[model samples]
Structures are given as C-alpha cells and as structure tokens.
Target: MMPSPYPLEKDLGMRYYASDSPGIGGRLRSSPEDFVVEELPLPISDPNGPYLICRLTKKNWELQQAVKEIAKHLGISHRRIAWAGTKDKNAVTTQFISIYDVTPEAVGLVRIKDILLEVVGRSQHPLSLGDLAGNRFDIVIRDCNPEELAKRVQAATEAVSAGVPNYYGLQRFGVVRPVTHIVGEEILKGNYEGAVVTYIGRTYPLETETAQRARRNFAETRDARAALADLPIQMTYERAMANHLVANPGDYAGALRVLPPKLLSLLVSAFQSYLFNCALSSRIDAGFSLTEPEVGDRLLFANGREDIVSSRNRQAALMQIRRGRCRIALFIPGSEPMASHGPMDEIMQDLMEKSGITAEDFERASRFVETKFAGTLRAISLSADVQADISGESVRLRFTLPPGHYATTVCREFMKADPYVMI
Candidate 1:
C-alpha cells in the first residue's frame, strides 16, 4: 500500500493509493472551464405533472446560492426548489432541478449571470438527492510532467480500471476549512453548542484573511453580533447561524436549525463518510484484499441485493464477484446500521467507540436535524472506463460514475498531487 503524502488527507482517513505507480503530477481545476460535470438524470417527467423541471447550467456558482437567487426572482420560498445533487461552485455543472408550482415562462424570465435555466419538462414529484443515474465528467489536469506522461497515464489508468479506494473527495468536507465532519462529530455527541461554534468559527489558512479574522474573533470572543458584522455576505450559512445566536442568545440548536435541512443532514452524513474512509483504510492497512471476500464478509451486488459470506455461500460469492455481479462493501452507520459481518464491522465499531458516539446519539441528531440517518452499504472500491487525451502540458480525462461517486477520486489516482492541487 502506498500512503498519501498530504497530512490533511491522512487526517481524513484517506491514507493510501490503490496504484503505486509514480503519479503524473498535475493540478486540477486550474480554471472553472477545465472541470465540467453533466448529470445523467433518471426519467421523472409526467405530462400533466405539477412540478416544473428545469435543466440548470451554471459556472462558478454554488448550488444553494443559485437556488436561493432563483427563488428570490420567482418570489417563492427556496424550499419549493429541489435538486438531485449539490454541485461544486468551481466547476461548469449542468443538472436538473424541480420547482414546484412554477411555469416554463416564469423559469425563462428568471435569469442570472453565468447561469442558464431551461425548461426541460414537468414532473409529478420533486427531485430528491440521488435522483440521477450517474454523472459524466470532463476534466483537465494542467501542467503535468511532460516526460513519461503517456506511460504513467497508462499505468494509472489500468490500475484505476481495476479499482481504487472509494474515499469521499475533499469537497465532501469543506475544501477551505474541512470542518463539516468535525461539526457532525460534535452533533452526534449531543453537543449542539460545540457543533454550532465549530460551524461558525472554525478557521483554516486557505480562507481569506478577512474571513479568517472574523472566524478567529468569534472563536475567541463568542460574540455572534461582532462576527456577523465582520463576516462577508458570501458566508451566508455562517452569518445565518450568527444572526440566530445574536437573537436567541445561547440557543445553539436554534442557530443550527436556521440553515437548510439538507445542509444539516449533509453535516451528519459527512461524519458517517469519515468513519467509512477510516475503516476502509484500516482494512488496507491490515493487509486485506479489496477485491476478495472471506467468511463473514458482506457482499453487495450490482442489483442492490446484499448477502453475507458464509461457509455455505463463500464459493458462490466468489463466483458472483468474478462475474462482476458484486463487490465487497462496508457499512456507513446511521441511526440503524445494517449488518456488517466481518472485520469491517469490528473496525467501524472500534472507531465509533473511540469517538464516544452511541446509537442513541444518532437518534438525537435525527430529531434535532429533522433528517433520517439511515444506514447504507457502499462498495470499498470504484472503477471506471476512462478516456484520456494528452496535448502539450495537460491531459483531459472523460469518465462517468454512478450517482454519489466523486470524480475527484478518479482524478486523484492519476494526478497523485496534493489534495489542495485537486481542489
């Protein structure tokens, strides 16, 4: 196993690379145009449906801000807008959104710079997270080592095609501060005050000097009003929490409640993602094969059916795996976790114990956040059929991943640069 060189990556439990070949060192997203994502949405249209479906294409815009602006233009509540997935602000992304009780004419009239909204169809239901079938990514890695570029790309391509650890990308945690999961850990421990403070005041060097100063002041003084005054308008969520605190005074949970429900759920889910990353890394650190299953291992099939490997079914499980029917998966624990019948379970249990979290803690978080923390299985590794093009000092990669997978995971295998380079 080849461990990553970045300390932040190690802290996130993304310790090793599946490919040991020297990476073709490069940087990703040097420009917004260099990284493009197009969602492969599932069919959700109905002729006489009440929901207006719009294909939203935006560059350098955050999804939440875009939705809020769209809501403002239509004079409607932001809650009426729904989307399949949240996209990164630094990329050129195209995805579908469902606006309830709206018309094509209204969507056409609403316009924002660098954002295009086109009426696609109507749907009987509003889009929810994971509504897409997959996503197609067109990415450029700039300023790579020119020498041995083709050879290294080939080696990495082959390795990734076989499989790479499916660790969540840096974007899952905030790229600037990476405090979402930290906030989540506090929430699961029933420390809403700690969570609110962390969300509002965690500082990172990557942040702007002004932003960092505001966060530092808040962390030191716990003066929400002052922080609100210092924080830039772009820090909408943080400002919302601060405003809530200034008014409610000591109602930390109320401060958290002011943010969008989806954002709240994502915070807790980030912690779950962190646990999965660590467990997967531990499995590799302990010399377990990512592609092989043993007695008591969980086998997850392509069709979403799951079975535990046992003395009776071990051979069948192996056969299914060889036939590309399934892969070994670890559980992402929620309020009610699925059975993980092997060392993966033991590893995750150890992590939970060390973190001082309990099942009841998740229950409390669900109630506080108003989102269900449901357990699910995730494959340990991901593979893709990649197409790479080399031209001068850069390489462009085109690939597709099923819903919920990160394109950066695939790009990191090829670039192997610092996580910040990818960011």
Candidate 2:
C-alpha cells in the first residue's frame, strides 16, 4: 500500500519547510519593507518595432496584475505584452515589458501612473517570449544586530559563493496546500479543465506516497488498461502509475508497445508533472521562484494583505537587523551591483539555534531540503540585496537566482530568528 497522503510527522518529506509557527505559517516572514513600489521610465531604441521596457517593483505587485495594467495602458490585450519572469509581490522587483505592433509614437500616446512605463532600448525583432537572461534587484534589510547581522551576511555571501541548492518556493503549493489538494482531486476526477486551471494557478500540492506509487506502477507497466481496470476509482493512482512509466526510458518503451492512446496521454501528463516538480524542487533548494523578471512569462505571487507591505516599511532598518529577522526577496542578474557568495547552511544553523528549533527538528528538516536539491537542475549564478526595517523588527533579503529555484529553502535557515506569515 502507498503511504498516507498526510504524513504523521507533518514534514511531508518535501524539501521546502512548512513551518508550524503561529500566524501565517510558511518559510518566509512578513515584512513591512518588503517592497519599494515605483514606476520608472522605459528606454526606447527602435521606433519602428516599438517596444517599451518597464521596470516593476516586484515585491509590491502581482505579475498577472502588472501585465494586465500594461496591456490596458497600451490599448492591447494582456496577450500582447511579454515579460522575462514573474517577481515576488512582497519584495521590490524590476524588469522589462514589450508592446507589439505599436510604434513609438503610438506608445507615447498611452498613459498610466501605477506602472512606470517608458520606452527603453527597442529591438527590430519584436520582444518574443523568454528574451531575458535574468533580473537585477536592490533590496534593503533593517533592524539587525551588528554581530549576528555580520555573521548572517557573511554566511549568505559564502552560500552564494559555493552555489546554493535549487529548490521550488512554497508558492508552488498554493498558499498552504490548497492548490495541491485541488489539483490532486481534479486529477482523480479526470477533470482536465480543473487540473489545468489549478496548475496554472500554482495550486498543485506536493507529491504523496500513493501518487508516487501509482506513478511508478504506471511507468513500469505502461498498461493503462490494466491500471484503469485495477484502480478505476482512484484516477490519480492510474494517472500517476502511467506517468511514472513514461518518465523512465525502459517504461516508455514498454508502454509504447502496450498502452493505448488515452493511457499514453495520461502517461505523458504524469511524466510532465514529475519533471515539473523536479524542476520546482531543484529551484527552491537553490533559492529561487518560477516567476521571472522577464516578458511573456506568466507567474503569480499571492499578495493577500496590502497592510503587510506598509507594516514592514514602517520599522527602523537598524532595529530589524538587531532582531535577526528573516526577509525574502527576488534578485535578477545585472539589475544591481552587489556581489553574492555561498549556501546558507551555517547561517541557517545559527538562526535555527536562535529560533529554538531543536537539533532533531533541524535534522529532519535538513533531510527534506536535501531531497529537493538532489534532482537535475543545478544551481547557477547568484546575486544579493537587502530589505531594511521589515515588520518593525526584521530585515528582508532578495537574491537573483536561475529559473526553477525557490527562496524558501534559504528562508528555512532563518526560521529560528524570523517568524513568518503564510497568506
């Protein structure tokens, strides 16, 4: 029999830490100074193939909402604009956005205040999807102790230098696992629309033992008929089993020879989910999120409460540093001039001690974090910035990471010092 969907230990064997701390619970703490909202002018180069580059305060706005605002201002559908990646709604973010089929003259006619839309350097080639390498960020961290703060900064620098593990951020599970449960149920029901919607919404839950076993069986047998026949009631089981077969080369060949078209499709989806989760976990371990600061990339960060931003901003930056608060931010390449170095393990250990996380709990959490980093995607470049006066007691941090990395894995290290809110 497969393991239970809910693990008794509550660790769930997933690398990303889901904290039991009170209030909004997750890997990241709430900060008032998380984001610096601004609308900067876009630089223009090509007037013919008119593309306007806009920078967003990633910490304050949702990627989807930002896109919508741009689309509306440009008199085009949301489909017309393109971006490199999504930015976190809680921290400051900057990136470029492009408007197609519109001339510079036409673009000049548009007006919007919330977005700092201006024409930056334009290209003859229309800004297609995935046109950016990465994003650059300027984050501020406040209210921290000189000694502890120095130690934390040194540790962060070291971790970045050594290359942090890539894991999926907690956002992938959709705000306390709601999306995951929704997708799991939808998959079980064979509701394609529901599954797709939830997946797009970033609501899919972490893989469970039953799901894993089903996937493994599906891959091994490549016999959808048998799987369906055997597990008719548990569609998730059948799908998982088929997907496992598709991912393994040996299973793929077996399934190709034995499974029918319907089963094949199910297998394909299963394979896709496995691959995606792998990427997601890898990115998280590396301290990154799926949303890029680029164009044409659809990413979402849940900014449930507007007050959180203000609260973080109201505190003294120095006090936050003294408190050893944990801050979360996104970083992009070349956006800022700061240097980055090393993984955050040592800092995590220190903060864990301060936060009162027992050595045993830390060990358990470390295991899950390790599992997430063992996958295919390896860590790439790293960048750093700080958030000050966050939540009147803590500091916020931003790191520029590669695609498919999570920021929470690093956040878990600071859980000892910084309490978080999961909205």
- Estimate the TM-score of every prediction: 0.98, 0.44
What pairs collide in candidate 1? none
Q: Model 2: per-residue lDDT, tens digit, 1-423?
A: 011132311232233332222211122323524433232322345655545554443345566666776667767777667665544666555666766666666666666544455556565554432355544333344444444454554455444433332333344443334344334334334444344334322312344555444444544554544444444353442344345444643343333323222223332223223333343334455544322211111112222111111233434422332232322222221111222222222333333244343334323322322211111112222223433223433455555443434454444333323222422
Off by over 4 Å in 1: 337-340
Lowest lDDT sum, 10 consecutive residues, model 1, at 335-344
> Candidate 1 residues 1-423, lDDT tens each?
589999999999999899888898999888999999999989876968999999999999989889999999999999999999888889999999999998788888997999999998988999999999999999999999888999999988897788899999899998878889999999998888899889988888888999989998998898999999999998999999999989999999899889898889899999999999999999998898788786877878888998888889888887888788999988878888545478788889899889998677888899988888877889998999999999988999999999889998999899888998887
Local error of candidate 1 at residue 398 (angstroms): 0.6
